[model samples]
Target: MSIHSYQTALVTGASSGIGAACVRMLSRHDMRVTAMDRDSDRLAELASETGCEAIVMDIRQTEELYETFADRDIDVLVNNAGLAHGLAEGFLGTGNDQVDEMIGVNVTAAIHVLRAVLPSMITRKRGHIIAMGSIASLYPLGLPVYGASKGAIRSLSRHLRMELSGTKIRHTEICPGRTETGFFDTAFGDPQQRASFVSEIRLLDPADIADAIEYALRTPLHVNVSSIEITPVDQVPGGQILG
Candidate 1:
């Protein structure tokens, strides 16, 4: 999808996965991109390849998030930095550290980004805010923390949309299920189990999710697509949870 003229897009988790894909696609559409991630090296690499600016900052730090976006004029804000499996197990197993980290990054960090970028957008009367959520939000499962986090995201997206009504600021949430990303391996304690859980499902590609982000941003100015859920056909599981 083609972006508006002279729009700047800020994508969190931009070093890789869905974030990176969004950055690349936005850049291709001639939108200036500020790619933010905790990994400096990977952020730089993505920047070089996509011709975007890279900001190395952990989302957990609110100050860093504000400082990173302080001087920039952003037209689109993609809150895409979050993980679930490890955090889920930790919450279930009573691991406080992991639980805190998960809440910090997935929920707290998103608020920080919104606070950092939203003021200018609302004042200027032009901007699009998108958050990456998951299907876990819709149906409750064993991963209480993760499901809760995504549920918060879903509410946040809808609330923001209503709050921004009668204004140019738009909000949308994209809920994707079972994407084929390194997250399953590197971010989880039992990569095999995680893989096995989704083995029979057709997973999404980073670009697929990215395309959804772009589409949400490119919708007609008068029309706001508040929520979009995307999942692979095989992962539908006959409208039931995978066994």
Candidate 2:
């Protein structure tokens, strides 16, 4: 099956990595893609490359989101903007400022993005919301704050599907593990630190994630792939857990 009806899509954090890959993939499917990100240069480059409308702004500023989507009829909303900080320091050791930033972008901004875009979907009675979640949300590990933020997304995706029941709208969370993206650069600021962590397991590509999202979007309307938990084969969960 294919999504032949959706004419437009809005992807957050769309300047690079998985976001950019999603934009490219959606464009291939003949959608007028809107790429939103804080990186003006990269956004402009992407717009030039794919003819997508690029909106440059900090998603954390919730107020601007209201103005940005005021009149746009977005058929698909890729709620993909997020970041991780202070991996070097555990929760208590991590600075409160870093903690707040994580929550601001990953949680607060994600909600506002949905709030800003979902109205149009509700009015039209059709839409698809794709959330970018992480393995951290499902498993326990070194990132407590980061994991907490993603866990909130996990809950949000479920509740959103519940809320949209009986409608044509669909909500799916893509939980990816060890993907090679700018995420590693932000999470493990130090090159060596990121290398050290990924040394044990092979990493998945950003395109791999975009492929999972494509699968979710292309499914028949009657079928809602609520959540997709994808990870590298070598990178299994901790002992005694099949998840």
Candidate 3:
């Protein structure tokens, strides 16, 4: 679909997967896109391929993040930078470092990005904010820390909907289940383990998740598509829990 509303966009964790797909989609529709990620090589490759402005930096660097976007009036903010670690180990069994990394990148840095862009959006009185979330956040699952991080996203989206009431700004959270991305690689940290985990189901593609984001952005200016949870038909996320 062609985009008529948004002019400039910033997508975080944009070197690959859902983030990269989003950059491609937005750039395809002629939106000026800024793709940010710590992977300089991949980020440059994507920029070369898509002609998107690439900012190579770790999302955890709060000072640099704020400075880089100070002059940008981003129409669409994709707060998609996130990761999961020690998922197979679960929370209690996971390393403290893994816990910190997940929270730092997913929740803390996301807020910083939002703070940096929102002041301008508030002044302009228009913008669309999209937070990358997961189905794990909405239900009981094996992931404790990772799920908690995304759950915070779920709450943030709700609050944005409440706080941005008449500012003409929009908040939408895209929650996808089992997408084929480097996310699994980072989450499992082992190729064989990651493969086995995903082998049973037909995983959703990064572009499929991007399609959901596009749909939300394509809606009428007055219509705010609050949240979308897209999953592969083969993937179901529930089981009985009785004490």
Q: Which structure among the candidates has the greatest TM-score?
A: 3
Better of 1 and 2 by TM-score: 2
How do the predictions measure up, each by TM-score?
A: 0.93, 0.95, 0.96
Off by over 4 Å in 2: 240-243
In model 3, the worst 10-residue window by lDDT is 234-243
Q: Which ten residues in a row have the lowest lDDT in candidate 2?
A: 234-243
Per-residue alpha-carbon lDDT of candidate 2 for residues 76-126, written as tens digits (9 for 90 to 100):
889999999877656777778889999999999999999999989999988
Per-residue accuracy of model 1 over 127-157 as CA lDDT, tens digit each:
8888889887876555688778889899888
Per-candidate Cα RMSD to the true structure, in Å, reads: 2.0, 1.9, 2.1
Between prediction 1 and prediction 3, which has the larger lDDT? 3
| Cα error, candidate 2, residue 221 (Å) | 0.9
Relative to the true structure, candidate 1 reaches a TM of 0.93
Misplaced by over 4 Å in model 1 are: 87-91, 237-239
Best-to-worst lDDT order: 3, 2, 1
| lDDT for residue 32 in candidate 3, whole number 0-100 | 94
Clashes of 2: 0
Please write out the lDDT profile of model 3 over residues 94-163, one tens digit for every residue. 7898899999999999999999999999999989999999988987778889999999999988988898
